[model samples]
Target: MIRRTTAAKGLALAAVLSLGLAACSSDGGEAGGGETTDTNGNEETSAEPLTIGTILPVTGTLAFLGPPEIAGVGLAVEHINEAGGVLGNEVSVEWGDSGDTTDYSVANSTATDLINKGVSAVIGAASSGVSLAVVDTFAEAGVMQISPANTATDLSGYGPFFARTAPPDTVQGAALGSLILDGGHCRVGFLVQNEAYGTGLRDNVQQAVEAGGCEVVYGGTGGGQEFAPGETNFGAQVTDLLAQEPDAISIIAFEETVAIVNELVAQGWDFNGTTYFCDGNLSNYGDDFDPGTLEGVQGTLPGAQADEAFREELNTWYTENEGGELADYSYAAESYDATILAALAAVRGGATDGQTIADNIRAVSGSEGGTEVSTFEEGVAALEAGEEIRYVGQSGIGPLNEDNDPSSAFIGIYTYGADNTYTYERQIEGSI
Candidate 1:
């Protein structure tokens, strides 16, 4: 009645040992004693607590995304450590900043420092530019990195080391294009941020629309000057965009999309003209903005909340552990799933070295041995049995291609009612 697999037992034992010590400890001063071999083929002892790093943009344009992403990662880590630490070592987490500037250089520096500190994996860089800056660093170091939110198309091919739980915005952009076509709009204007996230999404959507024989009326860049989340008063840009009077408009900034909506409302722009927002704008909808602002708006999202299967547990877990805050936005669930997938990969990889972990990531996310691993226990068993394992997680079934992009669960549709409630509309299963 109380049997445990070797990996599980190792993790449990490690957790006990870790709990006996401090919940947080740095390198060279931790509790456990089992040594794992490094890439150099030399035997190295596992630290008393295994450490992972999270790079979050806690105070910038993308700041709104950072907390939920961190919360998800933290929850996954907590769940893992509570069940059993990895390989019988308590899991510890370290923090680094992505800064508020949306600068990849800042993300790069922080990621580099984390690498030097010897973390097995990293769990963030929600901004696409930041992720791009550090992808090569993590890849070369053989460190496994899982992104919760970076949806830029450039990242799919960044490296073997870079993988994300969220489907890239290209998929969402294309779906939005289709949604526009379905809603009987032919020409539209776009006001996009000039960052990797905004540009990539806008480009994809524009390409999709062009391919569908539609025309782009006008496109301008925003978010390049004075980029800040929770900022409103886009009167200048709205005046310019309204001058074009296109059939519709796409707002592609992260949180600044709200500014665009507010600007439209202030000028009494036609909200009934099918203004479609991307996933980036999902979390920012609230009563702070006018209720009529997003009444007829449609949102294009990658993967939706599994509300029926996951909401109750999600709400309970978040409230108990995270002060009643739950991630109900894009990539929030995916981020949680990514953390679990990484931990499971570590267990299946049989060693904690970053290269081994990276290799194990593919095994779990790709189709090489999918049937063998469907749950945490199954993955551990497969590792013990020495069988290759593939972990298909709850973040909408992953089987990546050579580019490390998910094949299942393409872009989907969501509609925002005047009550500021988002409803999942439909799922698009093919490439746009």
Candidate 2:
């Protein structure tokens, strides 16, 4: 009985998908669908399944999100195949684990393998650092790369081939700062990992916090304290931030968040209550921490709360197929949407080639003038009828903004309950 709501509906910013049978593209035949030429003068494409590669964290700090994120792409594939597949064929996935940013070895190798395999797109690299590590590879190869959970503002200029369903941390950071000030916290301190994700978000939060007429006791001007990628010792970082005696604190870390939160408690700080978490560490620390330790803690993440029925369905699918409940739902909806949007763009552009998908991708995600559809089947049907579509996915994400990001999307404010986990408190909508 988890509580859920698409609360962004009341506050959504601008945003704006398609489907159909074999359609015409500049290419005589789409590589993913109908017929393609072989050097052997044969029209047979390889019997190997055409795949979408996923680079989710499976062995790293973000592994807690692996199950749900993996399941998300799985379910999207399920839905695509049911709609007669993308381009007259069933869709498949190439899965790879992104072992966080401390070492790019795993992500680099996995990305290379997926790229070499000719996947039309790569669907992850959830951490901003992880994504940046090889985003240039995809861009150089002209491949479409979509992220389900990347929010660092720096990624805005990563390139056209890179798109994300998750709004940038600029948006989430601002909202978080505004939320803090609105709550009357006049002095704030931030503890962040020293990485693209942490630093970028911290900078944005600092901007918003300062703009809201508050003082930032830590970070940049207050002497920003940064931790290494895999650094687990938080006692020093905690001491650094608390030395400022700030009224509120912000913790930006991955698995390391657990250690830091616990340490703050040991130091008798209202670390959980007056503290805030961004997407990087906004997860179910419920089972790992003592009951109610993280209760009343607040955080913000892109996208509105997903519909409960869809949540149940995704969980049911995972339970039956992968066993056990979907552990975390943080970026699951965005992951599903990223895969589906890529697939639909392929269909609409009438090819499974990366370049084609890239060119027509924005057509399915902008602010206005398209038929609105939710599921793959519905989008396909509309395209068959020769109608354009704008898909708002499970998380209530809107159309892509001018910069090829979810310009208009929701930033859900979440609060940990007595279970030491979180539920959506509300969704704020605006463009960043």
The number of the candidate with the highest TM-score is 2
lDDT of 1 at 125: 76
lDDT digits (tens) for residues 291-354 of candidate 2: 8788778998888788788788788867765546876687889989999998877766666777
**What's the distance in Å from true for residue 255, model 2?**
0.6
lDDT over C-alpha atoms for residue 325 of model 1: 58
- What lDDT does model 2 reach? 0.76
Q: Which lDDT tens digits does candidate 1 get at residues 364-393?
A: 765575454545656655665556666765
Consecutive 10-residue window with the lowest summed lDDT within model 1:
1-10
In model 2, which range of ten residues has the least summed lDDT?
A: 16-25
Tell me the lDDT of model 2 at 392. Answer: 76
Local distance difference test, each candidate? 0.66, 0.76
